[model samples]
Target: MAAAAPALTRSRRPRLGALERRNLRWGLLFISPWLFGFLALSVFPILYTFFLSFTRYSGIRPPVIIGLTNYERIATDPLFWKSAYNTLFYTALAVPIGVLMAMILAVAMNQKLREVGIYRAILYLPSILPVFAISLIFIYLLNPAYGMVNALLGLAGLPSPNWLGDPTYARISLVLIAQLGAGQWALVFLAGLRGIPIELYESAEIDGAGAWTKFRRITLPLMTPVILYDIIIGLSLGLQVFTSAFILTGGGGGRGGGAGPDNALLTYVYYLYKQAFQFGQMGYAAALSVVLFVVSLVLAGAVFRWARGWVFYEAEDA
Candidate 1:
């Protein structure tokens, strides 16, 4: 009886006709371009870099096997430690601030303010500005002596800090530059805020929930999923932060010398860049990138695990 049932089950797994099978094959063939690109550009480079990490491979020379040397160098290097520290600080400061600002702006903009579309466009325009252009503009705005920042400060008789020129102010300058993109993040959060049913807020209002109570009990809880998404994105973007620092600090190799005046802006990716291109340490750069990936993975995993308790879902009752 068991053998007969097994035979019956085998026949019930409906097979595709020749035309269907042919179509499937053709579909795979059509997607071969994507598959090839993934393999070549993404997969292969990652694997090759992983292997390269254990060797001493300058850009022009063949990789010479040197087990653990690169990792050891990374561990012992003072500059590496400084860059990592600065990167973490930037991440800590920027992510939360950006998240909060985006949420606030989104909520305000959602309030049916006059010509709201115009406001949205104006706010979003900063996010789309070219990095170079923004950097150039910021260059003048933050000019230590003649810049608007200092000029405003000087009006109040406060000491002016060299933004790009001083170590203490350089990392903060980078963080400020990063917040320019917060509008884009704000837009994403705005969409999420809009996704929340107006009925929920109305119900809270009818129930005698004050504005703060409504926000605490209803809005924050419902917004968690979106917050988690933005948090991950901000974290990743924070880690991969390179271009702004690169353009601002003069590309880690130029007359600027170290990142800004005192290595304040040498984030992880920037360091990897300096290693690969500036020092021609391709293999080592690859290893550093892998370490960066692992760190991001751990951080993201932590956020995901923590999000579950805090994140609310409308389907909980369902």
Candidate 2:
């Protein structure tokens, strides 16, 4: 009976028509450009970088194999350690602060108003500006003596430190720069906020929940997935922080020699750029890139695992 059933199932299975086979071929042909790009631009470069990490190559000469030397050098380097620490500290401070600010702005923007679109546009404008332009504007704005930021602080009877120049304030200044671009994140959060059922808020109100209670019990719990997404995005961007730091620190001409005072602003990506371009250490740079890729992968996996408990889904409940 089992042998008969197997034969029956095989007889009943449908085979592809000639038209279907033609359609499949055309579909693959249509997407071949993307497939080629994926192989050539993405996959090939990644594999090549991994291969380069084990060899000495200064762009002009043929790569000479030197297994594990670059990795060993990275393990012992103080500047590498400093850059890693700075990158982590920046991500820790910036991601949470950026998430909180974006959430607040999103909640406020979610409210119904006569001219809400105007307010939203104004808020989102900064996020769309070129980073170089923004960095330059902030460089002048944060000038210690006569910049608008210092002048405003002085008016409030607060001392203003040299933002880009002082080692103590440089990273914090970068965090502030991150905040200025919160509009895009806020928009994502706003979409999440809208997706949340209004019935949840109404139910909380029926239970005599106040604003804080409703926010804690209803709003925040539902927003965890959005927060998780934002955190991941922030972490990826923050850990590879370069452009603003590079511009503000005067590119290759800063007090700490491409690093801000005392190497305080020398982020991981900036240090990698220095190694590969400035110092002609391509193999070492490739090792650093690989390390960064591994660390990011681990951090992302940890976050996803941790989120299993908190991130609620309507589909899961259904």
Question: TM per model?
Answer: 0.89, 0.91
lDDT of each: 0.84, 0.87
Task: Enumerate residue pairs that collide in model 1.
Answer: none
lDDT of 1 by residue, 182-225 (tens): 88877888888788889999988899999889888877888888
Predicted structure with the largest lDDT when compared to the true one:
2
Give lDDT tens digits, candidate 2, residues 1-318: 224222233556656668768978999999999999999998998898899999998877988999999999999998899889889989999999999999999999988878879878988999999887888888899998769999999999999888877876998988988788999888989999898889988988998999999888888988998999998888889888999888888787543335987788899999999989988889889999989988999998998999898887666742
Candidate 2 Cα lDDT to native: 0.87
Cα-based RMSD of candidate 1:
4.6
Evaluated at residue 37, the lDDT of candidate 1 is 97
